[model samples]
Target: MQYPRKSYRIYFILLLIISCTGERSTNSKNNDSAAHNRTRYFYETVKATEDTREKIIYLDSALASIKNSRDTLLPLLLDYKIFYHNSLKEYDTSFFYVDSLISLSGAHRDTANLAKAFYRKARIYNYLGEQEEVFSNSFESRRYYLAAGDSSQAGRRTLEMALAQISGGDYLGSQETATEALSLLEQEKDSVYFSSVHNIIAQVYHERELYNDAVPEYRNALRFAPSLSDSLSILNNLALVYRDNKDFDKAIATWDEILGKADSKTKILRYEDNRAFTRWLKDSTQDVETELLDVLRLRQELDEEIGLQASYSHLLKYYLDKNEALSRKYSEELLKLTRKHKNAGMELTALQNLIPISPLPQTRSYFQRYIHLSDSLQMASINAKNFFAKIRFDEERKQEEIISLEAENRIQDLEAQRMRTRTLIGSLIALLLLLALSFLIYYLRQRFKREKIREVHKTESRISKVIHDELANDIFNVMSSLEAVAPAPVVDQLEKIYLRTRDISRENSDIETGENYITYLKAALTNITPRDSRLIISGETKVNWSRLQEEKKIVIYRVLQELLVNMKKHSGAKLVAVSFAENNKFVEINYSDNGRGLNWKRARKGSGLQNVENRLSSLNGKIEFESREGKGFRVKILIPS
Candidate 1:
């Protein structure tokens, strides 16, 4: 779901430096002593104010209060400004505030808040109907979020990106991006976003006429509905799906149920019109004309353009078979409304209806108009898709170019730091080099040992990089292109490949030997284990992990990881168990699986088994394997503590 990082620095040197400036003069300090509290009060008042101008006034005051201070309130105030101006349809002003925040966040090297700046800009562009900017900014926000390890925020950005793609007729990309968002949202259990993602997926399926697939996804959206309005919206979508698939009975039943609970005049009107149209479709003899016309007049009174489009189309369809004059009337009304709304798809539908009923001269004119508009819309749709593809491609290309520039920058920075260190050491050595030769020899020997340890970690990082850059990205590109064209089984298999490649990349990456190491290790093991198999882990808390060398811990992790991979691939295991124990000198792990046993005597050591052996050998560890023809596979590993 995530690409290889743009900031791939292998080393970090932490140095804290404080300026020697004296405390500020009280007279020179800003007027506000409690800047934080005052700014918070201003922000809260803005949130409570419904009037746009009043809200902006409070936001401006808050911004002025923090104008000279780089206090955290600066970005908070700017974000509020952007949100408020955007809602008032003042996009230029919204973008101005967004740019200000982006600059401030960048100056402070705050990637998290920088991501917010871009996300806010994406929202503004989304409202302006600029799909490319929406997708680009949303993706930019996601990159920063992923860099910060905030998957929940990254997922929200991705969901917005998916919505933009779908709006631009990029259905396949939208579906794939939505699914990726779901994966990022897996740990958050955020009902609102969960519902949004599934709703996106359902809409994609509905667009493709995969009604059966869309049905369950809508149900899933309903399961996570966070409010009554959201629930009613999803229920309306579900009924539409049923209606589209021609299961009219189910559609009408769903429509009637939601009609009872529909709280707003708009929703009631829409749902009522939908139910009446669906009933007419179910039984052409049904008399719904009176209800449909009344809804149309009400929609006209309200000037509801969207509702009127549906009403015009339904009335046209009803009169198409019986009343030529009425059909013509409705068709022209639909065409005029669609053109005014600038809805090309509905405009095409209106033209189609008009062409069939109009006189010869009008029919010819209508047909010509339809052809021009249809061809133009089709071309635009196709170009929109490619433009999006170009946007994504350009970003990947830009990232690739940045990789080397960043690497060189890091190298130069490191070299400059080393030069400073060497100069300091040179001065000290000139005075004491010969005086502490014995100590110098011991220090050099320890430095060599530390370098060797670093090499081990560097090697792990290289392997992870190879898997990600060489395998995962390439697989992702292939999946993106093949998603709409490839057979279902092939796509599914490729998806599995992508998942496994990512897992391998993560599994072989650097190990964290901190207190959370055990938690990460346990989660890794759980992830690799087959979902169908029951896994029992014992004595994980009993082991004295602090006693083990960091290198030894890495080896144990890799060895167990290999075993799990081998089990998942080759062992048809129903139940698997791993037990850990450690004493004064050694740690031992026993892994067993209830599956078709391997032949211990003639076990041709596979790559996975060999890798496990090599990792254990590097740590001076020992392993024992036991298996038979019809029994089960078992492995016991021992490493120095």
Candidate 2:
């Protein structure tokens, strides 16, 4: 059935994709016998069908259930399709599938499959008699197979290409290709292909009419022949070359060996005919007619068309001078056989035989017929080459278009992925910058707190030095003068004032900013506690006081002291508690008192209490005062230790 051109292309690509993907899946995971049997069913069905259209129909039917499936035998199905089309000489359709194989294999980078595709292309070109294309395509197949490390296939393709070159009369090129094939196969130790390469080289030499040069190659081919059938075939070829070289003795002797080895009647008759013909050529007086005629009759009876042509040519040559009418009769028989087979070479030989024997009136007609047949063959060969070339060119252009579209799609996909990657990178960079900014803010705030606390320490140190060094010294000197000259009440009052000045100096003294700091703080708190009020310190051992900064430690010590002093002087409370605790994130200290509390809103801030608020604020800590007129005066302090 006919279909639109687009439909065929679509179908081809679908098959190509399915086949390659399925082939890979099969290699990796197809172990089920049922799946293999299912594949076998389809593969055998299509392969067994000889008719091209019928095979394609069977292929379509088998593939009907294969829609978008990972069928394990897709490659087999494609192989049979190519096979059936090639058998029918439908090279265009065959080429279509081959190019699809190339595209699919290339898309997946399947080196072996690409070699197979080129091999099929070269074979089709061989059928079209386009030897140039055959050689080129075969070379490509060999190159790919070699790259895939398939030495046997590489050698086989090279030898086949060499044969193509020889057929096109490129003797030197054929010799070189054959030698390359030999090099490839020898390493593999493949006797079958090794012998084939030698045979190809021998043919190349024979085609140049260098019988002496061809002898050794043929011998080499015979030496490497792997099987009995192959050995006989090579022997028969060797004998033919010997006869063509006019070495009739050797040719007859070679045929004797062939006849001895022959197991079938057909083989015996063919060998006997060749031997008799060779002996007749060697000695024209020999009575070889009976044997030659008998071979011809037997071949005809057996309907062996090829053997009949050979027999007729032999008889015609033998009778050409002695019996004109008999020679003419044999030539006519040969011509009929050649015509039946449509073998242009055999027909040309037949026409050449008839030309010399025909009557004068018929001579020109026979010559004209020969010339016409030769020209028709030449024209047909040229036409076939051009036709196949045109198909290849058209297919290649379409292939290029398909490749361009696929490339464009791939570029688009890559661009999209790049865009996504860029976006993700940008997001990561932004998140990093945000984290860095947060860390910078935290560092600056901590630095500011530390500097502020240092300033408070420096101020307190200056005040303590002034009281002890300058003020207390002047008071002591005045008291010493009053003790000697002033009234007793005046001297006594000045002495008390000097003692209070010394007490203020001691209160503002430098703090111990070390491990002994907590001990010093506890002692100061206990020393200041009134006789009536009790001081309680809990959870102090739980705090890792050494981890806190020196300035923060000093501040904590001062604040606690101020609170205890105020409580002793004014609060008149029974109990005071200072608690410390450490958690995963922060160190915490809670100071609370149960004392007679004044109205918190109405209470004025004394210098000492205000000093406590300033100290806590500098360290990023918190404080709360809770008091009542008739209830206990309570102070709650929270310092981030």
Q: Which candidate is the best by TM-score?
A: 2
- List model 1 lDDT by residue over 1-641, tens digit each: 12112221110000001111235677535544566678888988998998989999998777655524456677788788888887888787777678777876776789999999999989888887888789989999999999899999999999998999898888988998899999898644666898999999999999999999999999999989889989999999999999999999999999899999988888999999999999999999999999899899999999899999999999999999989899889999999999987888888988998897899999999999999999998888798788778877888888888997898999999999999999989988875877688778877765554456557767877898899989899999999899999999999999999998988788768778878888888887888888998888899898988766676767777788888888888778889999999888779899999988877655545788887887676666799988886699989998877
Top model number, lDDT: 1
lDDT of 1: 0.84
Model 2 gets an lDDT of 0.79
lDDT of 2 by residue, 202-276 (tens): 887787789998889989998888887788878888898999999999999999988888877787788899999
Q: What is the TM-score of each candidate against the true structure?
A: 0.58, 0.66
Per-candidate Cα lDDT values, in order, are 0.84, 0.79
lDDT for 311 (candidate 2): 92
Query: What C-alpha RMSD separates each model from the true structure?
Result: 38.9, 8.0
